[model samples]
Target: MKQLISYAVAALSLVATQAAAAPVTYYIQSEPYETVSNFTACPLGGCTVKYAKSNRISGSITLVAPLGSNLTDEDIDLQIHSFSISDGQNTYTDAQFFVDVFAQSARVSTDSAGNLTSFEFKFDKTHGTPYGEASYADSKAKVSYIWISSAPSPGAAVAASNSTCQFRGDNVNGNTNGAGCMMAYDTDSQGASSASTTGVTMSLTPPPAPTPVPTLSEWAMILLGVLLTGAAALNLHRRRQTA
Candidate 1:
């Protein structure tokens, strides 16, 4: 009788698993048609303009329990990956950006001579809504990028070290801020000669909500199973006594 009850429990467990649904998956990407700005450290007591003119910003996001498997703003954890940002000449990887943004840190990408190429100071996810109506909702997350001149800049050399403003410098930090030289960067996003294309997209649908516990019918069936097994045991005992 005990063995019968155990078997019934195992059978119910299987049913519960089969009834449970899998969270769907969705692929997301975006295009930030905006220009970002950054300011270099005033080593010489002056600030230089640095900007990341977004050439193309795209990535994919996996959302759980999303409607229409749509990746909308929800109280769910987001697993975003495969992101890339480019400014025609230089490119920034997702690892160098999102990891720091989610971790509440800072990331800088540069070439040789410690010159800033593209850097993200603030991570903002409120920019564009890339989705369709009644299809799936999406969070229009956008981060601005600034474009800067290459390493060994002439302005840094001319301004930092010259008769106008005599200043000393050395390569203490890596390619981040142009070796303590104030550098001016340019990012033009609002103009006729700007990048025009479709917005960043988060397609391939998304995941659904997780399954809840078993229903009332399932519990009733469990009770029925116990009762039937107990009854069978009683009948078997009676037969044995008659024999």
Candidate 2:
């Protein structure tokens, strides 16, 4: 009977550990977008140019991995949760854009200890932007907007003239055509704001660890109760024997 009880307790503990080790989702949130000030732009003829502006951008992405997985060695799926860009005069939300087809190469790099080091990806506004690219190499990440559109709504299809590329790291087999490095800057058609050449700091937040099922203390309490109940039954048996 004691052996059976021991086996049951061990099984429960193993189950708990396995449950706690299950994969988890993590969130990487972009700090509030910086406002690009003293910005200037010229139209086609270069005669009239817009001057001075401010803009704000915000968004977050999600990645998944085992609770203790080494992110540096993991090729995780990337999902963009929310994004927005504003020109101080006009604002746009993620609904107005889509992750480029090459987004599959979007990746995160981390130290061997699982600390994030850098991340990179490209996305385009729905109307006609070739690509909005960002790469993290140092303490800050730099972002560049190839082009932007004036579409006021989200979920709109990419314009026929729109072009984009996959990250160069994703251009497997030394193929460079249509790779991210080929992307070129273009004049914004609708005056959508562009991020400054300076870097934008981003923060990554991991999901809280799952609460262990039947914590060690709780298991001890459960074991104590079972032992007490068994003792009580044994005492009752002794009383009946005496009777």
Candidate 3:
């Protein structure tokens, strides 16, 4: 009987472990858009006064890992198990976006001392057009990219020495894409332009509220019921033996 009870408890333990859910979250707060620089220059195509802008967006980007998977701080490139964005009003899921943002593009960077330097999240939709090829798209398929770093500061020219500023996830082959983490939300034929920013803050999302545990009295009641059932079974076994 003791052995049987032990086996049953072990089975319950296995089931609980299998049914458990583990998720990781990252919190992102964006800075307002601002002008980075302005200069008068004549390009090869035409003459114009050009300026650069940093990335700034108003929304919450939530990233979740796959079930049964373990994600650690040391993991350089992370899989985009689940992705969503909430723009203070509506939330958009991965299905709404034309591109699969999870193809090993999400990454975290650290310094030599293993201190977190910065991290970036890249996702965009070009209305079925191959990413990077779509200069413009509809609202549902608009292209969007977000990058938040620690160095060079927002609205400042990207530091050449700041190697961690690169966004090489989905777009590989040394594509210098998503520079300065500039965000664009334009839905016109002219295409969206990157925006400048004052600064952005990032941190680990707080853990969800913990489930309440049973009180000692409740646990005692459960234990008493189990003991009674076991005792009844033992008593029946003894009677059978006597007969």
Candidate 4:
């Protein structure tokens, strides 16, 4: 009996330990578009400037992973992978205006099973800046790209604009025809760590376990009764043989 009780205690301890180390889940959300300004050199000599305009192009992306996984919040970098802009009619591509935004570490909470009960991604946009210039034309430029673990080096011709001329930049400078505007990439890239951002913390609580129909105590009592009966029978047979 003493041995059986010790084994049960050991088993329960193991179960508790496994429960505390379960897997966790996390979610990601991104907002890509923000306002930016473009400058142009005057047709004759002086520098021409177009005040930054508000580009309403924005989108979101979500990713999931276990709690304390190999992936870090810093790995959640967002680059203007690709994009295109439109002026209510025609659309153009802005391939060179790629930028990298760094994401802040995530705030994570887990349950007994080590599963991620909740998570939030916070990012800083100040790290991002324009990479290359576009041609001076009057068409909407659209660009697209990916958000990955690290920043990528500049590449060859990203995409083409509607310009009849093969201009390297996305034709951002309005030509004599007054057609210079950029459809830049907008996204959120955040890093993760053990700390929390915004000075505000978030928490996740696991749902309560369902009640058992008969209860554990009742089952335990029934098992004890069966064991006692078997023990009594064995003792009676031993006494009869001795007599």
Candidate 5:
């Protein structure tokens, strides 16, 4: 009877250990940049030209958990987001705009299991000017320089044109997480007082299961069962000797 009890206790201990070994899961979200604008200008016929600035550039980022992906605060990272410039009527240089994460009130949240659950960013409309320049010349006339301004006065403007979010960690192969963990500006030019937005999605794939650790209770129960079995065998041996 003692031996049977010992075996039953051992089985119960094993079951408890397995019950505590369930896998962990995580989810995360990212902020959206849906408001952006700037201005540009060009020269025509050796005369100064002016252009009206239009604000119509913005975007968002979404991260998805890959088949075997796991995310931790220490392993996640991001880079400055920027945008390029183009005049529907002229040419311009691609400029790098820095995102003000703090000003935009950007934040990332996670679940109790340490999984990223949500992310968001709020953009503020600050006043500012957009400017560009181009040279002009009449047929066979001496080349002259021309400058154009998008706004009458320069003011505070949204800092970033392109943006990127980088998730670095083990098992993250390049381009394997759907969109490769990086997102940038999707427009060609900066304008004034308008909203243009784009979005990218990424996933966090968890790696293989980790090695299990036996809990203290499990160890105690195992030890008790072994001791009980030994004691029972010793009693049985004594009874046989007497018989």
Candidate 6:
């Protein structure tokens, strides 16, 4: 009985030791999308969202994952920290744009088996203008922006002649939740805005599962102990029967 208990403890110890550590992988899935499928608001509560309801608009989202693909706080910070957006005219850049940029959003992707494989990140307005000394703002104001068809309303927008920067803020009336704004700079667009660059998509994926190996030294030791304990128990039982 004592031998059986000892072997059991040994086996548990081996598993615990092996389970202590795991390697994490990092990689960028794709360029950040201008708009996700059902997302039209800033999911990460505090980020400022600009609501634009323009019929025709055009812009480009340039997202860079400075770190690998961990998406940790540092990764997120770096992602936002190294971001730049342009409509061939106005541009924005701010390091503190990561303000309140959190994860827990409904923007996620799934595998063919219907499993949650990865999730889309959230963004907030980083700055208002080029010389804006202030960097970030709190998540307090739940301002409901209204986008109308024919007219432009009171909202933070970077407008241009043949081009329009409507993607800077989220269209709350449209129920969109993506506002990753950092710094701001405006340029003159020579051509009109197109629908082509409006839907840039990007996602962060998780590392694959670790594979099993038959020659694992630690696992081998655990197996050996179990085999020996069973043999000893059997041998003791035989001796008692003979006695």
Which numbered prediction scores highest in lDDT against the true structure? 3
Error of 6 at 103 (Å): 4.2
| Cα displacement (Å) at residue 78, model 3 | 6.2
What is the TM-score of candidate 3? Answer: 0.41
Candidate closest to the true structure, highest TM-score: 3
Name the TM-score of candidate 1: 0.25
Better of 1 and 2 by TM-score: 2
Q: What is the lDDT of candidate 5?
A: 0.30
Candidate 1 residue runs with Cα over 4 Å from true position: 1-24, 29-56, 64-99, 102-200, 205-243
Find the 10 residues in a row with the least total lDDT in model 6.
146-155
Tell me the spans in candidate 3 whose CA falls farther than 4 Å from its real position. 1-21, 36-78, 86-92, 97-104, 110-117, 127-144, 152-191, 206-243
Clashing pairs in 3: 34-196, 54-195, 54-196, 55-182, 55-183, 105-169
14-121, model 6: which lDDT tens digit per residue? 987665332222322222223211123333233222222322222222334222333322223222324333322233334433343212121333455433234333
Q: Please, what is the TM-score per model?
A: 0.25, 0.38, 0.41, 0.22, 0.21, 0.23
lDDT of all predictions: 0.31, 0.37, 0.40, 0.30, 0.30, 0.31
The root-mean-square deviation over C-alpha atoms between each candidate and the true structure, in angstroms, is 26.3, 21.0, 20.8, 24.8, 27.5, 23.7
lDDT of 5 by residue, 90-145 (tens): 22221312211111222344555644444333222111111111111212211111
Backbone clashes in model 1: 16
Relative to the true structure, candidate 4 reaches a TM of 0.22
Order by TM-score, highest first:
3, 2, 1, 6, 4, 5
Model 5 misplaced regions, further than 4 Å: 25-179, 186-243
Q: Candidate 3's C-alpha lDDT?
A: 0.40
